[model samples]
Target: YRAFERKYRKNLKALYLVHPTNFIRLALQVFKPFVSAKFGRKVMYISDLSELNQHIRLDQLCIPNAVDEYDAQLLAKEKKPSAAASNAFQLNSTENGKALLETQQFGVSLAFIKENNGGEVIPPIMKTCLEYIS
Candidate 1:
C-alpha cells in the first residue's frame, strides 16, 4: 500500500471490515490489546449485515434485474473528454458555427451522470451554505 501510494502520490481511502459475529469473539480472545491500542475511538462495530448493506451498494453480488441491457450499454459507451479539449468546446452555437456543439452537449451530460452517480454533487440550494463556510 505504501509503495502504491508513493508511485501514485495520493492518499488512500478504504473500507475495512471483519465478520460482525466473529469479530467480537476474536477480538476478545486474541486481538483486544492490539485493536484497542491501534484504533481507539476510530473503530466502530456494527452487528447487522443489513445495516452495512444500507450504506454500501453490493451491486456485483446482487445485480438488479430492472437495469435493462440497452441502458447498461449506453452507460458503458459514455466517456470523459480529454482534459485539454474539455474546456475548449462551446456551449452555444449560431447557424454554420465551426464548433461541434452536439459533442460538447453530450460531454456535459456524461459529466453530470458520472458526477451525480459517484456522489460528487450537492443540491444548488445546499451549495450556497457550503460556499459561505469555505
Candidate 2:
C-alpha cells in the first residue's frame, strides 16, 4: 500500500478508508513515520455511507455490500457505546503549548477553513489560503 500510494500520490485527489478496522488504523500509525507529512494527511476514515456522502457525491460512487455490512456492525457497536472511543478528530493540548491533531487520515484538507465571520475565501486558490489557524 505504501508503494502503491506513493506511486499515485501526484494524481490522487483524496483517499477514503471506508469501513476501517482498529487493526488497519494501527497499521497506518505504525507506518506513518515512513511517509511524508503531507502524504499522511491524505488519508481519511469514513465509517459509514452517510459520512462518506459528506465528502463525496454518492450518485457517482459504488460501494460493495460487504463494506456496508461492516459499517452497520460498527454503527451498532457505537450506538450501545463502548469503553473505547470510535475513530474521530481530537485536539490535544500538550505541555509545550502546541496543539496537536489526532485523527486517522486526519489532516487539514484545505489550507484555509473558515474566516472570522464564517466565510470561506473566494476563488479557492492557493494564495488565498491562510497561513496560520491560531
Candidate 3:
C-alpha cells in the first residue's frame, strides 16, 4: 500500500475491498492511526459483487471463477439456519482436531479445508506442497 501510494497517489481513487470479514475490518482499525483520513475515506468496504457493481462495471474486470464460487458459498451460508452454521465454530476434539492443530501451509489451515470441503481428501498439489514443506 505504501509503495502504491508513493507511485500512484495522484491517480489513485477509491480502493474497494470485497468480502471483508471481521478480521480484515479489525486489522484496518488497528492500523487506523497510521493511515491518513484522506486515504481512509477513499477506502470502501463492499459486502459483495452486487454492491461493487453499483460503483464500477463488473464485466470490465477478469474475476476468477474461484471468487464467484466463494461468493456463492458465502451467500448460501448466510441463508442457512444459525444452528447449522454454528457447527463450523464448534470445538473439534476428534483425530481431525489434532491434525488440524498441526497442519498449516501457505496460510491455509487444514481445519478450514476439511470443514469446507466435507472431509474430502486434499488435492494432489496441496498434498505435494504440504509434503515438501513438512
**What is the full ranking by lDDT, best candidate first?**
3, 2, 1
Error of 1 at 19 (Å): 4.5
Instruction: Estimate, for each residue in 56-123, the C-alpha lDDT of model 2 and write its tens digit.
Output: 88889787778778878888877874433332323322213545444312233222233322464542
After superposition, the stretches of candidate 2 with alpha carbons farther than 4 Å from their true spots are 1-7, 77-134
lDDT of 3: 0.76
lDDT by residue (tens digit), candidate 3, 42-84: 8899988888899999999888998898888988877775875
The better-scoring model by TM-score among 1 and 3 is 3
Candidate 1 lDDT over 4-103, as tens digits, reads 5554423323332423457565665485565434333434554334444575665545534443454355445555666656554433342244534465
Q: What pairs collide in candidate 1? A: none
User: Candidates 2 and 3: which is better by lDDT?
Assistant: 3
Q: What Cα-based lDDT does every candidate model obtain?
A: 0.47, 0.65, 0.76
The count of residue-pair clashes in candidate 2 stands at: 1
Where does candidate 1 stray beyond 4 Å? 1-19, 22-30, 35-43, 60-134
Q: State which candidate, 2 or 3, has the greater TM-score.
A: 3
| Model 3 lDDT, residue 77, Cα | 77
Instruction: In angstroms, give how far residue 18 of model 1 lies from its true place.
Output: 5.8
Which ten contiguous residues of candidate 3 have the minimum total lDDT? 93-102
Candidate 3 colliding pairs:
none
